[model samples]
Target: MFVAAALALLATMILTIVRALSGPTLYDRLLAANSFGTKIVLFIAVYGFLAGRPDFLDIALVYTLINFVGTVAVLKFYEYDDSVGGDYQEDDY
Candidate 1:
């Protein structure tokens, strides 16, 4: 059962990657990326349980926090369209 759940999560992660690549808009891509991150957290936790390693849950939690922060930072950068005192503009990229 655990193996089946892991396989399903892996399949969803693949679909999420496809959506991120082919999204019609920036927001759609970002949403897909966020969803992908979430799936990763779930996958980690489930795998940890299946492997009987409780320590892996801590690693998954840390990853989840990092993912949330990284996503917020990216969204903020896009919202501002500039970084480092307006010296760096989005179009510059």
Candidate 2:
């Protein structure tokens, strides 16, 4: 069962990578990237369980946090056009 799940997750991860590469807009690509990250976490957990390595779950959890933070940071950068902690001009509109 776990093997099947890992295989399915791998397939979906491939599809997600394709979407991220060919997405029409920035948001689409970002969403695909986020989805890929989530699938990776699942794959890690599944693989760890199948292999009887409990430590992979810890790695997966850490990756999950990183994914969430990275997505948020990217969105912030897009919104502000500045990720370097520099000042941003206020839109006159």
Pairs in steric clash, model 1: none
Clashing pairs in 2: none
Estimate TM-scores for all models. Answer: 0.82, 0.83
Cα-lDDT of candidate 2: 0.87
Cα error, residue 36 of model 2, in Å, equals 0.5
In model 2, what lDDT does residue 67 have? Answer: 100
Best by TM-score: 2
lDDT, candidates in the order shown: 0.84, 0.87
Clashes of each: 0, 0
Model 1 is weakest, by summed lDDT over 10 consecutive residues, at: 81-90
TM-score of 1: 0.82
Question: Candidate 1 residues 2-66, lDDT tens each?
Answer: 88989999999999999999987676788899889999999998898778885788888888899
After aligning candidate 2 to the native by TM-score, how far in Å is the CA of 52 from where it should be?
1.8
